[model samples]
Target chain A: MQEVLRAHLEQIIPLTDEEFTFIESHFILKKYKKHQFLIQEGMPVKYVYFVVSGLLKLIHTDDTGKQQIISFAMEDWWESDYQAFYTQTEATFSLDCIEDSVVLGLSLESYQTLCEHLPKMEHFFLQKANRGYMALQRRLLSLMTSQAKERYQQLIHQYPTLVQRVPKTLLASYLGVSRETLSRLSFGV
Target chain B: MQEVLRAHLEQIIPLTDEEFTFIESHFILKKYKKHQFLIQEGMPVKYVYFVVSGLLKLIHTDDTGKQQIISFAMEDWWESDYQAFYTQTEATFSLDCIEDSVVLGLSLESYQTLCEHLPKMEHFFLQKANRGYMALQRRLLSLMTSQAKERYQQLIHQYPTLVQRVPKTLLASYLGVSRETLSRLSFGV
Candidate 1:
């Protein structure tokens, strides 16, 4: 699990063994069963998780209890109610497992400490944040420009693995389409 | 203009005079009138801009020449075809002034040099990126969950100044509604 983290970090910034050890100290490993909640809505978001195995969804539940999957995270991905985590506020979104999962969790304090102690980690995180920002920008643009069926096709074309793994209902929510509409489209596709 | 950039950077990280000078040297200031294009679709993106004054819109034009606004930027904000700028690819979106604008343009090479030479800049950029990601996430969620009327209300409530500054057609484009609908809604409000 730690090796997975090391490799993920190395993808952006090479880490020395000693540096990796120090970095690893800031994170605690945790495991969850499918459907177990990592961060619950309205509760304090304590840590941001880096997935080691399995899959998770960042979910937003509306006033009527309609749950929407904002995004998904699998192995090598980072998941959090980020606005809440960064601001130390109550989680607006809940994170839960789509499969039995293992993750390395880092608290806000630990994240700040790590960056302060090793500026290289700041560089690493900046790279990650920039990439994440770019992704969100693309997603926002897609939402603004594309129709539901087009978005579904775009998702399938770009993330065939994710499309295969995510349940249709959740995918429908993510794509802003009705379940029946998604069903018809998926059947046709 | 340089002071505006310095003040924006200082909001995240303190910079010495020497440090600010070093940072300023990497940016080139340019002015554009309303409707002038800072970036055009399919052109190689050369710089990521930090707005010193006035407003800009990031726009996407579909095959039929219909345009949709992806986002807007004002004084103290940053705007770019970031996907293109970062990847060194031709821009899929165009950025143009909505108001007579002044911006500091930082080339990718200069960006790299700034981050490498002054790691604080990386931290500053990380903070900005995180905030941008959160904003995009909120926008995406709103697009998924809200009706056009509700989104228009939310925008008016959240960004009153922007609502006042932007034209109805662009606002309608941003809200994914027809101009007539937006005009009716605005008149009622």
Candidate 2:
């Protein structure tokens, strides 16, 4: 589990053994059964989790209980109510495991302590944040400009693992299209 | 001018006198007349500019020369070809002064030197980048989910000064709507 986390970190930033040890100590490993909620909407989110294995979905539900998938977390991906985590607000989205999963979780307090003690870690984290921004920017642009078919094509191209693992209906929600629309786009249209 | 710049810095992170002096020395004051390009597309972007006064537009043009406005900068705002500035790639967008302006420009080399020398300054910049990501995320959501009218309303509510300073057509482009659509949205249904 530590090796998986360390590999992801090393891909972005070369960290010293001491820095790696600091990160390892803060993370708590846990398991979740399929369809379990890691976070729920309107609750105060205290922890951010990284998927060590299995799958999770970050989603928002409307007044009528229709869900909109915001993001998917596969192995080695980070999942959190970022706004709630940063601002101490109630979460607007819930994070749920779609499959039985192992996760490494860290509380907000411990993350802050990590930043305070290891400034270089903050730099490393910021680099990852920049890459996240780049990915989000591309997703946004595609959402704004692409047709349903185009979006489906791009999604398959970009997240082949996600397409293979998650249901088509959930993928349609993430793409902001109707399941029927996605069906046509995928099969017929 | 220095006082105004110092005030901007204080808004994000309080800079010590020595740190302020260190940054001030690295910034060069640049002036641009209305209608002149500050950073042109296809060129290597060497500097990121902070608006001291007046307005600037970041624009990307289509194959037939139809312009899409990416963002606008006003007083105290920072503007750059972020993809180019960060990666040292050829700029994909052109930045033009919408009005006569004075800007504090930092070359990539100077900015790197400052970040290397001042760790706090590096954190300060990283925080700004995080905020940029947050803002852009909100913008993307707004663009994807909201109608043009809602987008225009949100824009004016957040940056009324921009409505007064920027032209209607550019604002339309920025909102991802036709000029006619913007006019109707602004005037009626």
Candidate 3:
């Protein structure tokens, strides 16, 4: 699990043994069972999790209790109620495991300290942030301009494994389509 | 205009006169007339513009030549075909002035030089990128979950001036509503 964290970091910036050790000290490994909540709406977001294994879903529940899937995290991906994590506010979303999972958790304090002490880590985070922004921009554009079928096709093309792992009902929510519509599209009926 | 850039930077990280001067040198001041393009589809994105004054729109045109407004950038906001700018690829979208605009443009090379030579600049960029990602996430959620009217309301509440400055047609496009629907909603009819 620690090796997974080190490998993830090394993907962006080369880390010396001592630097990797220092970086590792800032993260805590945690495991969660399937359906376990890692973050709950209205609770403080204590840490951002980087998935070492398994799957998690981030969702928002409306006043009417309708759940909207915001995103999913799998191996090597990061997840959090980032608005809460960054601002130290209560979460407006919840994160729950879809599979028994292992993750590396970094608290806000540790995040700041790592950036302050390791310039390369700051660069690494900046790259990740920029890529995250770009991904969201692409998603926004797809939502604005693409139809449900196109979006589903995009999801399948981008992450076939994700499409396979996510239940059809959840995938329908993520695509902003009804389960029936998803079924029709998926089956080409 | 330089003061505007300096002020924007200082909002995140305080900088000395010498530091500001060094920072300012990496940017080039450029002015565009209304409807002038700062970036065009299929052209290499050379710089990311930080608006000193006036307005800009980032748009993508589909195969049918129907345009989708990705976002509006006003004074103190940054706008670019960021995917193209970061990846050094041809832009899939175009950025054009809505009003006669002045902006400070930072090239990729200068961006890299600034980040490498000034660690604080890297931190500043990381902050900006993270905030941009959060903003995009919020917009994506709104697009996925909110009705057109709710999305319109969210936009107006978030950027009242932007709502006023953008034409109703573009506003409708941004909210993913028809122009007639926007007219009806705006007038509460």
Candidate 4:
């Protein structure tokens, strides 16, 4: 568990063993079965989870009960309804495990404590946030300017691992298109 | 001029007089006449300019020379083709002054050097970058989900001063709509 956490931290910033130990103590190891809901809309999101080995989906349901998949996270990625989490509001989105997986959970209070105790950790979080914002910007632009085919191609090319792990229907949902449209695009010549 | 710059810096993080002096040395006051381009597409963007006064527009053009307004910066706001500036590539966007204005220019090299030399400055820049990213995220979401009138309202609500200074045509361009549409919306019974 420590090794997995250390590996993830090392990708963003080099952490000393002591620092890693300090963080490890604060994190809670969580196990979830496939298709399990980690969070649901209208409930408060108490924790942000880092996926150690599973796939998670961040989704939102409209008034009509139509789910819009905002994002998918594979191993080493973090997932949360951050707007809700940070603001201490009811969740605007839901999180569910797509595959049976291990996760490290960090509560909002614990994350704040870490930021106060370790400036480097704060820097790492800030960098991750910036990158997330940048990627989302590009994704929005693509969604507006490109067709479904182009968006699909970009997605597969960018996150082939995610494409491989998820079903075509879920992928279609993530792409904000009908499953039939995805099927036609995939098999239509 | 120094007061405005100091106020801008304080909004993110407090700085000592010595630190402020260090930052002050990096800025060069530049004046632009109305209709003059501050930075043009395909050119190397050397500096990020903070508007002491006046209006600056950032625009992106397509292959056929049709332009799309991306953003506008007024007093206390900083403007630059940051992606191009950071990557050392030719700019994909253009910045032009709509009214004669004074701007404090900080060259990319100097700003980078300061970030390396001053940890506080680096933190300040990181936080500012985070804020900029957030604004861009909101803009993209509005563009994707909101109608033209909604976007126009959002823009005016955020920057009423810019709304007053910039003309209707430019405002229409910024909202991704036509001059006639904006006029109709503004005057519709």
Complex DockQ per candidate:
0.83, 0.42, 0.89, 0.32
Q: For residues B1-189, write the lDDT of model 1, one tens digit per residue.
A: 688888889999999999999999999989999999999999999999999999999999987788888899998889898889999999999999989999999999999999999989988988998899998899988887887888999999989999999988899999999999999989878
Better of 1 and 4 by lDDT: 1
Write candidate 2's Cα lDDT for B145-173 as tens digits.
Answer: 67799899999888888987898988988
lDDT of 4 at B120: 65
Candidate 1's C-alpha runs over 4 A off are none
Model 3 residue pairs with clashes: none
> Residue by residue across A1-189, what tens digits does model 3's lDDT show?
889888998898999999999999999999999999999999999999999999999999987899999999999999999999999999999999999999999999999999999999999999989888888888888887898999999999999999999999999999999999999999972
Name the weakest run of 10 consecutive residues (lDDT summed) in model 3 chain B.
B143-152
Which window of ten consecutive residues has the lowest lDDT sum in model 4 chain B? Answer: B137-146
TM-score of chain B of 2: 0.95
> Once model 3 is optimally superposed onto the true structure by TM-score, how far is the C-alpha of residue A182 displaced, in angstroms?
2.0
- State the fnat of model 2: 0.21
Candidate 3 deviant stretches above 4 angstroms? none
| Superposition error at A65 for model 2 (Å) | 4.7
Question: What TM-score results for chain B in every one of the models?
Answer: 0.97, 0.95, 0.98, 0.95
Collision count of model 1:
0
* Order of the predicted models by lDDT, top scorer first: 3, 1, 2, 4
iRMSD, model 3, in Å? 0.8
Cα lDDT tens digits, model 3, B1-189, are 899999999999999999999999999999999999999999999999999999999999988899999989999899999999999999999999889999999999999999999999999999999888888889888887788888888888899999999989989998888999999889972
Q: Model 2, residue B166: displacement in angstroms?
A: 2.5
- Runs off by more than 4 Å, candidate 2: A62-66, A180-189, B63-65
Best-matching candidate per TM-score: 3
Best by DockQ: 3
At residue B65, give the lDDT of candidate 3: 93
Q: Tell me the deviation in Å of residue B146 in model 4.
A: 3.0
